[model samples]
Target: MQDKQLNKDEIAQLTEADWKQRLTSDEYHVMREKGTERPFTGVYNDIDDKGVYRCKGCGASLFNSDNKFDAGCGWPSFDQGVDNAAIDEHVDDSLGMRRTEVTCSNCGAHLGHVFPDGPRETTGMRYCINSVSIDLDKNEH
Candidate 1:
């Protein structure tokens, strides 16, 4: 990948079939195609399961269940990440709106978005992530 953005057609043609072959159906849809999965349908939504969540695309450690929080917005929300450098934030202005998009810093797999409207006690931010974008490490904590 280059520092310059790849056009959709360019991105769509960049060995996507290779990625499809490498990823599960759901993961291919979300990560390679930017498809959003329905909220509350994810395994992590109400999970008490112990683990570290990693980027499905590249196995990069992202979040722990300990950092998971119920944002009441139907998505598995977290006020924090496994670490400050665990992910990267990008500017997204699609759909006539502006938002900050988040992704795994290691692999650039889209996790979801971050918002300023968060609990004031900590970072005051919410990283609303897609369950399909992550793979649980299962009790690494």
Candidate 2:
């Protein structure tokens, strides 16, 4: 089933309590608290189906199945987002390292981090995302 997308205005109105109520414990931890799921433990880590991945927090379209690739990184790796505006990237300086953190643009929910190492033949970018942060809508066609 396709989920309804929320606009920025709608997302802005959501309180932390609302998010806590809407998301599961894992989803709340990953998406709202900026936590990472254990490597290889995510539902989408080994998924090879055709679909669009949406933000679990707000149902905003984030990654297309065509952009997903197995990076052997124990996560759902994508070369790019569904579009430039589909994700918001920020510089993360925690864990004594610097990395680009990717988030849901509409809801400002943490998704994961992006790395420079990816398939050279493609965009050469790897968006390592947490499965709890997103929901996949399998395409019928």
Best by lDDT: 2
Residue-level lDDT of model 2, residues 27-137, one tens digit each, is: 899988899999999999999899899988888889999899999989999999999999999999999999999998988999999999998999999999999998888
Supply candidate 1's per-residue lDDT for 105: 78
Candidate 2's C-alpha runs over 4 A off are none
Model 1 ranges off by over 4 Å: 1-14
Q: In model 1, what lDDT does residue 135 have?
A: 75
lDDT value for model 2:
0.90
> Model 1: clashing residue pairs?
51-139
Q: lDDT tens digits, residues 103-132, model 1?
A: 877656778899987788878988899888
